[model samples]
Target chain A: MTLASPLAALGRPVLAALAALGRVAIYAGQTFGALFSKPFYTREFLSSLLHVGWLSLPVVGLTAIFTGGALALQIYAGGQRFSAEAVVPQIVAIGMVRELGPVLVGLMIAARVTSSIAAEIATMKVTEQIDALVTLSTNPLKYLTLPRVLAGTLTVPLLVAVGDIIGIMGGFLVATGQLGFNKATYIQNTLDFLEGADVVSSLVKGAVFGFIATLIGCYHGMASGRGAMGVGGATKTAVAAASVLILAANFLLTSVMFGS
Target chain B: MIELANVTKSFGSNHVLRGVNLIVPKGQSMVVIGGSGTGKSVLLKCVLGLVRPDQGLITLDGQDVAKAEREAFLARFGMLFQGGALFDSLKVWENVAFRLLRGPLKRPKAEARAIAIEKLRRVGLVPETADLFPAELSGGMQKRVGLARAIAAEPEIIFFDEPTTGLDPIMAGVINDLIREIVSEMGATAITITHDMTSVRAIADRVAMLHGGVIRWTGPVKEMDVTSDPYVQQFIHGRATGPIAAVR
Candidate 1:
């Protein structure tokens, strides 16, 4: 192909991507705009809390423990080269509280929560249920989206807090049992080394990532194109968009939280 | 009464509605007959505010539909979607009494259930059917349930989108008869979009033929076949050779 043709092909996709981003921004704005409106569906909000928060704990907990255990081992081995092996307890505590805990939980929520929300909404659209909602005098954004996004934003910080504690416990288990560190001393070291700012930043990251993951899911699902192919495409795009946005938000949040 | 004055809509370059104008008088059963993809569904959606028209005004009584308060306006009408569109998460009774159990029309659960069962009975469904989910029912049963839901609130207006689709001939006839009887019984203004000639004769007082994104001919159902308009005649007779092309 000629250079001009290649450049045009690249330009086309970039323009398409920019247009999609603009659409997503509008969808997100509409979703948030509905938040302060009257006739709030409290029943729907409680239901969303159970689905997006309570049902998600098992997967998040499992991922956290495994990650914490593996992180402790890696840190222990890597620090041995510098004859800094004893720093394992402090390093694992700081790492779990400040970074790995929230990031992993956010990713897991992106995988489990985002994909499901997108598929359900997209299927509803394909089946004309959204139109049915309109005909029923219920706003789809209020009835379907706002509750889930609110639930995600509110509960995920708690999930991250739980994840951080579980991860630190996992690290403590490995360090005390496998690494032959004193159990009491390891716990003491962890408590002493972790700062209040670390935990605060971790929870803040959780809330931001939660909002990003859920809003993207809601946007993709509601804006899904027509038919079966469209629903499948929407579900795929929701997960992809949510996962990318979570990571990007994690970076920005980290920079703002500690970069200064 | 509902009036459409030069309403138009287009998606990208594909123009779906083009300056179409029609009126449905109060308490009249108006059937819109058209081939698939002729914007029959789009027209109904436009009036319901599900799709925004690109131009012109749609008014109910004397006020513009789009400018009216949304929930109050929607409360005056009910729609039977082409696919039934029942909330799969809800049981049959819950789906039927959806309005009664929520929003401004909230009622006691027991009362709502009783009303749902009563409405189900009106549509020839058993009270036990109210407890079952929509997925457990056959297509004909689902259609009947959808009908029951539409009439449950005693809406002043009802729109039926392909009410007879995907059913056997006998079931289709049953649904058509029920739609006609219910519309008259409630003294409700009704609009139905269908291509089924049987449905047209059974449900409509007047029939309007939609073709090429515009109303080709509109008159009493008796005059539909006898109209001099080639497009309406060709459509009613299902002719292979006519001014209306077989392909888009």
Candidate 2:
């Protein structure tokens, strides 16, 4: 192969990546534009809120409780090596609120909500339901994408707040009941250790992650090819992309808020 | 009248419609016939503005369809998709009255439901079917519901894409008869795209045969059987050997 040929091959992928990014950016702009227009689908929005927020509670609760218990155990074990065993309550509180709670909840939503949105929309496309909506004089962006994205963005922070409390409670239970600590003292220390910034950062991250997850789901779905393979591939890509973006956003937010 | 002049469309290197020209006059049922992948559906989609042409003009009542106000332009037309295209998340009545429940035709819930039930009854569905989701209905029932939805808004123009596909022959006959009755009773301009000759005989006022990216033959349905055109004969007769090849 010629030198120019290899160079062209490398440049082709970069160009394709840029084109995909541009398409997503344009889709996002159109979605936001539709938000201000008439024909807002109130019923769809309320249904989406139920799916993205209220319906997700049990899964979020279970994940948070289990994670918080395990985190306390690990911190206690690690602390004993440095004569820092007594610091378990404080570290667990900070870790759950500042990092694990938001990140885990974001990942779960990606797995659950993002995949679901992608699959449903892709199926609609394959069946020509989106075109049906157009023929009905209803914009698909307004009726389908906007409500779900808005619900995710507005409700995830609430879920994150709820998750943080449940996770702290899990840690508190483990510390007080199984680790030979006074229940009242553990509760007081945990509450005293967390700052307002930690909670704020957690919620902010939750909102951003939610936006990325739902937007990626809608984008990949609308762009899906044809047939069963198309639906499967879109769901896989949506979940993967949402999860990675959430993690990357978490790192950036963490550094911005706490880096020295 | 809806008119297409030199309409052409292509996807990548595969040219679908090339210099397609046809006129569907007001208040007539025009059936377009062609083999699979002959761009019959694409022609319908182009008129609906669901698919834009690579080149050419489509006009409705002498106004360019591409430039018409979107909602108002769409409001004048309704379509029944090949797969029924019913929204699975919606109940049957809600699917029928989709346009009435929202957008420019917004109606109160009770009024919309009443209209939906009326439309459903028009298509021979019981009132109880109105409350059931699309998935709960059989394929034939789904198609009837789709027909109800298409006529729900009382549009002046209606397009049916493969209206009888994926149904038992008896059910297909029922759907074909329903389409014929509805189009005539409404006095609406109707365009139907299908390869099924039975559907063509049962539905068309005029028949047009699409072949090799163009209109090969078009005339009154009564004259279709006697047409000397080879493509029209081969397609209508389901011949394996003709001017058109059987295999891609």
The numbered model that scores best in lDDT is 2
Model 1, span B1-248: residue lDDT tens: 99999889999999988989999999999999988999999999999999999998999998999999999999999999998999898899999999998888889999999999999999999999999999999999999999998888899999999999999999999999999999999999999999999999999999998888888889988888788999888888899889988977
Cα lDDT for residue B218, model 2? 94
Question: TM-score, each model?
Answer: 0.96, 0.98
User: Total clashes, candidate 1?
Assistant: 0
For candidate 2, the docking band is: high
* Model 2, C-alpha of A117: deviation from truth (Å): 0.3
Residue A236 error, candidate 2, Å? 0.7
Q: What is the fnat of candidate 1?
A: 0.79
Model 2 TM-score is 0.98
- Going through the candidates in order, the fraction of native interface contacts each one reproduces equals 0.79, 0.97
Compared with the true structure, the alpha-carbon lDDT of candidate 2 equals: 0.93
